[model samples]
Target: PLAEKHGVTIETSGDVAVSVGSHALLLQMTMNLVHNAIVHNLPERGAVWVTTGVRSRVVVLAVENTGQKLPPQMAATLVEPFQRGTGRTHTDQAGVGLGLAIVKSIAEAHDGTLTLTPRDGGGLRVAVQLPAAPPDTGR
Candidate 1:
């Protein structure tokens, strides 16, 4: 949906089990991240990928996208309130620049952590790590 509108491709994979405090909040977090990714992309032919998994009793979700190279300094402040990244100009009602900030708050509320890393080449990688829920075991 958004991928097509943004002229980008979206790829998702991995585990579907998430044990957040509220599913609705989780959905909001996902929406914000995906929206931010699509709206802030390279404007054409960009790619966004999301992955979910469990590691060391922690559930991990990562959203990465190709975009303008972000400076390390700028990236560190991306989670601050109203702090927009460079080249964030987009006509699609980009947002009030609170996506990462909201994501950080959501992760913290779940006793989790959010990390923003500038990708090696260009783009950014955002990771959310929270406590994992044990296997269902068909109970």
Candidate 2:
């Protein structure tokens, strides 16, 4: 809904189905990032891009969006519980800021890592990297 409303273009690639600790947790993480990409984007001309790939023994899931730049200090604390970006705390789009926090928690629980990088142009890029599981063998 947000994507359609903002006309955000979503481009995806790579093998989406990969062995992970928990599918449900991953779904939640990806959904939150994607939602944030749309909600926190520019009012117009917003864009989102999602991709997945395997790097070494890790599975990478990344979401990138176009929006206003976030300060380094704010971005650093974004994964903290209840920490939200400026001007986003009192608007209709206001969030409790638990989204990224929860994402980070879940990643850590699975022995993975989550990173948020400010984009070169504007907006942010979030990536969650988890250890890839060995292929299932016939039991």
Model 2 segments beyond 4 Å from truth? none
lDDT of 2 by residue, 49-116 (tens): 89888877889888999988887667788888876765445566747778898999888988999999
Could you tell me every candidate's TM-score relative to the true structure? 0.90, 0.90
lDDT tens digits, residues 1-139, model 1?
7789889999999987567487888888888888888887787899999999988789898999999898888889999987788634343465877888999999899899999999987889998898987777997
TM-score, prediction 1: 0.90
**Cα misplacement distance, residue 91 of candidate 2 (Å):** 2.5
State the weakest 10-residue window (summed lDDT) of model 2.
85-94
The residue pairs found clashing in candidate 2 are none
Q: Each model's RMSD to truth, in Å?
A: 2.3, 1.7
